[model samples]
Target chain A: MDNQRNERKNLRRQRRIELGTQKRSPLGWTILWLIMVVFTIWTMFPIFWAVITSFKHTGDAFNPTFIPWVQFKPTLQGWHFVFITAGERTLRSLKNSILIASCSSALVLLLGAFAGYSLGRFVFRGWKNKDIAVWILSNRMFPPVAVVIPYFLFMRTLRLLDNPLAIIMAHTVLNLPLGVWLMMDFFRDLPRDLEDAAFIDGCSHLGAFFRIALPLAAPGLVAVYVLSFIFSWNEFIFVLVLGFHKATTIPILIAGALTSKGLEFWKVASISLIGIIPVVILTTFVSKFLVRGLTFGALKE
Target chain B: MKYAYRKHVIKWFFLLPCLAYLIVMAIFPLTWSLRLSFTKWLATIMENPEWTGITNFRDILFKDPRFWSALWFTVRFVFLTVVIQLGIGLGLAHLLHNNFRGRNFFRVLFLIPMACPPIAVAFLWKMMLHPDIGIINTALQTIGLAKVKWTTSVVVAPFTIVMVDVWEWTPFMFLVLFAAFQALPVEIYDAAAVDGASNFQVFRKITFPLVAPIIVTIVLIRIIDAFKLFELIFGITSAGPANATEALSFYVYLTGIKWMNLGKGSAMSWIFLLIVLGISLILLSRLRKKI
Candidate 1:
């Protein structure tokens, strides 16, 4: 034991001597700081511009000034347009977006939890787990455009076009695959010993899953829920093709403003700012989960 | 026997709804689309589609110049966006890889663009790219440069689409690669340093090789996702400036829904699917080896 400790200490010294502290020079640090500042400006500039655009009055909206408060007087006209005159449409779409995103996320989590439990916990003779997992993920590979045609025809046939129900079902189809993959990763990371302990305590498999695994995977559930909600809220193609008047979303409205004559910059910017509020809030809350969710747990930070 | 039956029932009961949903939503629609591609369907509620056997594909392949142009446009768009996004994303990742004050704050700020909805981002760019009042043109003019048309000119519209995509998704690449950089074993760097390797040499030999697979994966994923480019064009250009910026997905949208040419649309979509799937299979196979 003494010899082992001495050898470990020697190895540490050797490592330190070889690596030479790995410190950056002041000049290097200054250059890095400059790069970072430039990047920060690049990332924030467009969003800032949108905010500035949203605040401008109709005349000032077309003003070619980059500075917001200095070059032009800011006004509440765009906000008023978003909230009051076009208020009903905005409120209706916002309601539809919220209802659809939440309900579909609930459905996805409920259904996906079951599927994930099965895949993560059990191994069958004929069903190779990896292949099954890959197959489930492959469902997400088909571009929404590829499938929108049939969905359109089917919705038309069912007379469910422009209905929020249709949008919810479509959103569920889009997010359920993602939900399964995410929950599968969560469950796989959890040790089976806990479930075994529950089984010994007279909990059946389903009870063990619900009582033991589900409670423990609450963070995973939040990650899944937030992601699915954001995805459903941000969906554009299905809403465009499927909805008409009754179920139009904020994204559709924003896109529509582009086609109308005389680019209503302030109104479009205001509506867009309103549109991204829910997503922005949710993403800020789950920013830590963003990378894991994006890569499907391929690279965990 | 009863216990075994119950076990089997519970297991499948959990799995069946998801399978059934995919079958109805994914498989059924795809098969229907394939069948629709082979017929001449004008999308009348009452009229039956006439079976027209491969003519749609033949036309799209040989006769349609727009189809080929759109396909080439999409390829160029994907290639340019992938290159630019990777470059900017890597630069940002490298900058943030070191310890710095407010690093976490900047990292979160970088992710904001991606977190915003794609439609909103596109519209935001539209607001910025307005030839008359857009901050971009305004900035250009302020700098004593000629203000260029961003999304309205035929020559520049495609590049504008690529720019919007790069703005929205470069963060995605940065986040992925940043995580990869964080996970890299510092001992390797230390050992290389001990060998008196120069900083550029260490980066070129040690860092680049370690990050290459991730770079590949990120690029492949970006290519696959870029093929589904629709919202940006739909929101920003609407496939306009004379169809200069029409991606394959936007073309699919135009042919099928806007034109109401269901048969031709279906054909275009199937061909699109085949190409996307072909690339995806290659990605998947390569991914299998790496992971």
Candidate 2:
């Protein structure tokens, strides 16, 4: 143990020496800081712009003011307008957005989790699993524009237009392929031993999956869940085409803010802020796992 | 009996609904569009659908200059956005790779743009990019430069879309590549260090080759998404300034929804579908080999 400790100490020292090349010069760090500062400013500018614009009065909104009080006084008018003036409509749309996004994402997640498990764990005789997964992923690439017109007509025919159910159904199709693809990769990456071990302990197949596999795949599930939710929350064309009056979402409302009289920047900014906030929160929380989810667990870091 | 039940019953039970839903929602519409493509069916006209076989496809393929231009513009948009996004994203990933304070915070911040709804992002940028009163031109004036027409000028309007697209999507490339960067084998770097490889050499020989696969996948994904560029166009330019920025999907939206020419729109969409399908096939095959 003493020798091992001494060897480790020596190895760490040697590592430090060799890692000297990895060290950036003072000039390098200054350049890095400059780049990072610029990048950060660039990344934050639009959000900052929106936040500030959202607070400004309609007259003050067009001006290039960077501050709340210094450049121009801020007001609650935009927020008030968002929550009160358009209160009934805004609140309804907000509720619709939440309900559609949550309900559809949950449905997609449940079906995806089950299908992903089967694809990840089970072998079928009739077709290749690879082919099925590839097919499912191919669906993710299907453009919404191609289907929107038909869905519009189809929903209108069924009197499903302006219904949350229609939007939910559309969003389910929009996100299911992604969810199943991500979850399949998740389940496939998981070791089979836990479930097998559960089985040996007399746990039923369903029990093993519920108690063991599901718990283990939680991180991947969370990643896909947030992703599906984000996509559904942000979906525009479906909500725009299929449901507008009764089932208006934040995107449709944002589009509505593009009034024929010309865009009222203050109003647009406020609504955009509402649309952005949930996704911002979701992305921040699940960002680490989201990278894996994006590539369908291809890079396992 | 138990084994068979678990295998067949469970597998089908798990799989069928996903496939079935996709069929109802995606395949059904797609096939309906395919049928619509071969006919002359204007949604505005109240008539039995006229089955005009191959005319829509032939016109879109051979006659319509607008279709060609939209496809061309979309192709340019995809190429430029994907390439620029990859370079900046990979650079950002590499720069952010080293341990630092507030690293995660910055990562999340960078990712915020990509997460913002594309329509909202476009609206925010549109407000900023206004030529006369927008903040972007406002900034240029403050910086002692002449104001530029960000959206109204025919020449610059298309690039305005590209710039906003890069702003909104470069984070996606950054996130995926940064994750790939994190997953790079440290031992190889250490070995390269021991062998006295230069930083450039290490990046070129080790890092580039290692993350090449991810770069491919992410770029392909970005290209696929970019091909469906409607929200940004719809929100910002609406294919304005002589239709210089009219993307394929936007053109399809115009053809199908705006004009109510369902047949021609559906045909154009099928062509668009084939192009995307081709790319996705390649992407999936590459992805299949990786996983």
Q: Rate the local accuracy (lDDT) of all candidates.
A: 0.82, 0.85
Residues A1-301, candidate 1: write the lDDT tens digits. Answer: 9998786556545544565433667887788778777777877888887888888888887666667668988889889988899889989988988898899999889888888877777764586666666667677767899888999998999999999888988998888877887788788889999988887787776888789999988998998899889888889999999998999987887777665577778888888887777788888888887766665444465
lDDT of 1 by residue, B1-291 (tens): 764675677777777788788788788889999999998888755287889999999999999999999999999999999999999888777666645457577667867887787899998888888887787898799889999999889999999999888888887888788778766776787778767897568768987799998888778778888998988988888889989998999999989998888999999999999989987776666644532
What's the TM-score of every candidate structure? Answer: 0.94, 0.94
Question: Which stretches of candidate 1 lie above 4 Å from their native place?
Answer: A1-23, A64-71, B1-8, B44-46, B286-291
Indicate which candidate wins on DockQ.
Answer: 2
A97: Cα error in model 2, Å: 0.3
**Regions more than 4 Å wrong, model 2:** A1-22, A191-194, A197-204, A296-301, B99-101
**How far does residue B115 in candidate 2 sit from its true spot (Å)?**
0.7
Compose the digit string of candidate 2's lDDT tens values, residues A1-301.
9998786556544544576633768887788889888877888899999999889988898888888889999998889988998899999999999999999999988989988998999987767888888788778788899888889878987899999999999999888877887888889889999888887798877788789999999987787778888889998988877885899999888877868796688898999999999889998888776565555444554
User: Candidate 1 falls in which docking quality class?
Assistant: medium
Name the lDDT value of residue B84 in candidate 1: 96
Candidate 2, residue A187: CA error in Å? 2.6
User: What RMSD, rounded to one decimal, does every model reach?
Assistant: 3.5, 3.0
Residue-by-residue lDDT tens digits, candidate 2, B154-252: 999999999999998887787777768766666787798879987678789998999887788778888888998999999999999899999999998
